[model samples]
Target: MPRPTSRWIAERASVGTSTVRRPDRTTWIVLGRAGADVAVVFLDAEDVELGRRTVGADSWATWAAEIEAGEAVRWVWNDTPRWYAELLAAGTRLARCHDLRLCHAILRDSALVRADADLRVHTDWDATPHADPPAAAPTLFELGAAPDAATGLPEFLDDAVREFARQRTAIDGSTDPGRLRLLTAAESAGALVAVELRAAGLPWDPQAHDRILRGVLGPRPAAGGTPMKLEDAGRRVRAALGDPSANLDSQPKLLRSLHRAGVLVESTSRWELAQYRHPVIEPLLEYKKLSRLLSANGWAWLDEWVHDGRFRPVYVPGGVVTGRWASSGGGALQLPRQLRGAVHADPGWCLVIADVAQLEPRVLAAMSGDRALADAARGKDLYAGIVDTGAVATRAEAKIAMLGAMYGATTGDSGRLVPRLRRTFPRAMALVDDAAREGENGGVVSTWLGRSCPAPSAGWHAAQSLASAVEASGGDETRARRWARDRGRFTRNFVVQGTAAEWALAWMADLRGRLAALDAVPDSDAAPRSGAVFSTRPHLAFFLHDEVVVHAPRERAEAAALAVREAAASAARLLFGDFPIDFPLDLRIAESAQDD
Candidate 1:
C-alpha cells in the first residue's frame, strides 16, 4: 500500500546486510506495510514461500531495485500505481507484474469462474483502485492487522497470501483457464502501460495548437468575451432567425426562437438540427463546433494540460465496461484530426504512429472464425471486402450494415442492410445475435478472452417481472422492452470490443518490452522532455484504444516501426492462435502525429 518500500519493515538492515539471493526462475516478491516496517514475503514461481525480509522504509526501494536488477522477478502487488509509481520515479523499471486489483476485477466477473469459487466473496477487491481503502498502516497477515486504508485490499501477509492463493485456485479451477489466464496477463500488462504512457507524456506543440485555434476561432479574446469568429457565427444565426436579441447559447430560448422562425425542431441536437433546411442551421452548427473547441481544448486547456511540450492524460484501462481505455483528463481519446498537427515530436526524434485497421470487426472475424469475414478482412478496407461479398451495394453501405449488426440497429439504412449481412455472413452475425439474446434474457455474456459483462441489476429484474405480470400496464411493458433492447445492444458489442481491447493490451505489452530492449541514445541526443525513465530510450509515448505512438530517436525510427508491426503479429498469434484474421496497421513514421 505504501509503495512497497522499506518503511513497513520492523527493523533496519544491519551494517553488513548481505545480498538477497533468488532462484533461477521467476520469484514473486509480495510487499505490504506493517507498523513501522515494510513486510516482504518472497515466493517462488509455484507460489511456495522462499523467504521473507522486512526492511526499513528508507531501504525498501533500494532493496526492490536490487531484486529487480538481479534476474527474472515478477512483483505481485495489490495495485500497480500505488507500488510502482515511486520505483518508476526512482528510475526503476519492472519487467512483469501480477496486478491483484486489475486481475481480481477480471476474474471476479469472468463467466468461466465456477459458481461456488471463494473469489466471489471478496467484495472489497471489487473496489476501484484506491477508492477509500483502509487508512491505517497495513500489517502482515501473520500479525492479524486490519485492511489497508489506501487499497482496502488485504494488506497483511496472511490476507495477501490467501487472496493470491484464492486467485490461483479460481484460475486453475475455471472452465477455460487458458483464456482467463490470458485475459489476466493482458489486463495487468495494460495497467503497467497506462502508467508508463502517463509518465512519458504525449508530445505536444503548444505553438501549433495556438495557431490552429487562432485560425479557426479568430484570435483569443481580450477578457471573458467570445472570440471574433464565434461571435460572428452567432450574429449570423441571430440574423437568420430575424431576432437580433435571440439567446443562441440557451437551449430553451434557442428552441423557441427556432420555432418562431419555422425551424420547428424539438431539440437543438446536431442530428435534429441537420434535418431542417434553415439558413440558421449552418451558422448554428459552426457556432457549436467553435464553442466545443473553445471549451474542451481551447487556450485555457492548453495552459493546464500541456506543459513543457508534453500532454499527460490519466488513462483508465478497463474503464469502460467493454474494456476500452477512458481518459480522466486532456480528452486523450477524442482528439480531433484538425489538431493532430500539434502532436509534434522532439527534435532529432520521430513518432511511429500505428493503429489497427478495423480492429473490432476483424476481432469478430477471428473470434467467430467466420472464414468468409476473415477472407474479406484479409487485407485493407474491411468494408470494401464486405461489398465484394455482395452484402451491400457500396462500401458506405457495408460500413453501416456491419455497425448495425454489432450495435443492434433496428431502423434506418443500417437496419435494412443488416439482414443482407446476416445472410452473407451468418456465423459472425449469429455470434452477436446470440450475445444479444443472452443479454435480453438476463444471462451474462463473455468476451472471446473471458471478460464477462456485468449481470443485470435488481432494477432490471424488477422491471422484467413487472412486465410479465397480469396487472402490468402498456407503459410498463414498453419500458421493460426498451431497457432489454438497450442492454442487448451493449452485450452485442461487448464480445468484439472487449476482445479487441485484449489484443491491444497484448500488442502494447509486447511493444513495451521490445522498445525497452532498443539501444539507448547518448544524453546529448536524448529527449529529456520525455521524463527520466524513457527520455534516453525508445519508449511508448502514447496509446489509445487501437493505436500507439512511439517516440524514438531518428536512427531507431525504423526499428521501432518494425517492433510495432512484429508486436501486432505476435499479439494476433497470442490471442487468436493461427486464426486467418489479420490485423493490418495504418502505420506511419512522422515528425508529428498528423494524419496523412
Candidate 2:
C-alpha cells in the first residue's frame, strides 16, 4: 500500500496535527490511489444524497457507483485484504496530511507515492480488441481457413507440404536467411513452423511485429521457461468461467493453461485476444518472424512504397480512445518522427495530401458557448489561434499547453500557461476541466457519445460530493476550490475532445465505405499494387492520429484529395447536423507525414 503524503491525507487520516487547520466544509480532494481507493473517495463523501441523484438519477447509476466504489478500496495481499488499517492504527495527526492531488510536478519522484507519471503510461486506454476480421472473413483468404494454410503453407504448394509433413523425419522448420528452412521431429507431433514473406497489403505483419507478436509467441530464449503445471493452471480457467467442469476439454484447459503460464494476455475483449495461440499459434509467430527478418530495416519497404506511389494504408475507426483512427497495420504510428520527402506527382502528377488544422479544439470551442474561443479558432490552427488571441506567447507553447490542458495536464510549462487559457476560453475549457476534476475526485467522466470512464472509489465519491457541496454552500471554500482549478478546467475541454473523436470516426467509416466500392482485383499480386492507385479506386494508404496519406494513380490524385476533405466535412455535418457551426478544415497537400 502507498503512504499518503503528510499534506494530502484528510484531517482524520493524517499522521501529525502540527500546523493543523480544518478544511472548508466543502473541499476538492484529488484521487490517484490504486484499486479501492476510488471507492473510498466516493463513499466517504460529505454529502451522499446529493451525489447520489446526479443527472440521469437511475438507481442503476447509484448502485453501480456504490459497487465500483467498494471494489476500488479492495486490496489483496497474498490473497488477503489489507491497506489503510496501519494508518488508522497509527492515529496520525491532520498536519501529517498532504494535498490529495498527485501532480507529476511534485509527487512524481517522491518516495511517498507508489509510482510516477512518467512510468505510468496511458495504460488505462485499454488495449482493446482487434477490429480486423479473422483470416476466414475475407473471401480471397478462403483457402487459408482450410487445412492448406493451417500450418502456414502457401496456397500453390499446399498439397506438397501436406505430403511432406505426413512422411518426414521432422515436420518442424525454422525461418532464417541462412538455414532458414529445416525439417525436424518434435516431441508430441509433426508440424511445419516456418516463415513466409507475405505481400505488402496483408494486415498481420508490417509493423508492431515485436509488440504484437511478442504478446503471441513470446520471447524465444535459448531455453524456454519451466513448463507450467497443466492441471493446476486448468483449475483457474474453470473457476473463472464459473463452471467447475467447463475446462475439461483440452482446448479450454489449454487456454486457461496458457493464460496462467503468461502466454496470453487475459482481457475481456475476445477480438483483442485473436493473437492468442497454443497449438494453433505457430502461423502468426511465423508471420511475425518473417516480417521482422525480411524487412529487418522495416521502413525500407515502407519507403519503397512511398517512392513508387503504391502504399495505401487502412484506417481503423475509433482506433484510439480519444476518437482517432490507427493504420490497420505497418509502422503507421511509428512513422520515423520526421517528415517524408514531398511526393512530387510521380514525375507527372503532384501529390495532393491535405490535413485539417486545429480540429479537436475548434470542435470544442463551437460546442461550448465560448464566442471568444470560437472567434480565435476561426479558420486557423486552434493552438496558434489561441496564441494569436494571447492565450500564450507562441504557437509552440500554445501547442504544448493546450494539449496538456485538454488531457488534464497540470505540470511543466503547461501548468503555468493553462490558467491563462482557462480565463480566455472558459466556455470551451469548462467542459474538459470539469471532467478531469471529476476524474481526480474519483468521479466518472464521459464522451459526448456516451463512452464513459468508470467512477473510481469511496474516497473519490466523497471528494466530488464535497466539491459539489462547496458549490451549494453559497460561494464557500469547497465550491470555490473546486471551480477554481478542476470543474472549470474539465468542462471546458471535454466537449471538444470527445466530439472531435466522434467526427474522426465518421470520417474513417466514410472513407472505408468509399474504398470498398472500387473495382475488384483480378489477381492477388495486382491487388496489393493496385491498392496504391486511387484513379479506378482511391484507397486510404496511411492514417495517423489526425492525418491521412493516400497513394493514388497519376490521374486521380486530385479527386482522392477532394474525397478525403469532403469526407471530413461530411463527418462534421453528420455528427452536428442540427448545429449551426461550420466545422472547417485546413487542407494541406503533402506527400508524407514528413510533408507540411
Best by lDDT: 1
- Per residue, candidate 2 scores C-alpha lDDT tens digits across 1-596 of 44332223233222222332332222222222122122112112221111111112133233323332321221111000011122212221010111111111112222222333232242322223232322213221123322223322224222222222221211111111111111011100000000000112212222433333233334422332311233334444555444466533344554574466455745423454456654423432333333343343233444443323333233333344333434454444554432243222233223445556777776776666578877776666677778888778998888887787676677889888888988988876776666666655444454544333323445545554655663455545464465445543553354456566555545655654454354433333233432222223444544454565555444555666677777777776665554444556555554333334
Candidate 1: where is the Cα deviation over 4 Å? 1-24, 34-38, 130-155
RMSD of each candidate relative to the true structure: 5.0, 29.5
Regions of model 2 farther than 4 Å from truth: 1-319, 323-329, 339-351, 457-496, 512-528, 531-535, 578-596
Tens-digit lDDT string for candidate 1 (416-523): 899998888999999999999999998899998899999999999999999999999999999999999999998999988888999999999999999999999999
lDDT of 2 at 184: 10
- TM-scores for all candidates: the values are 0.91, 0.42
What TM-score does model 1 achieve against the real structure? 0.91
lDDT of 2: 0.40
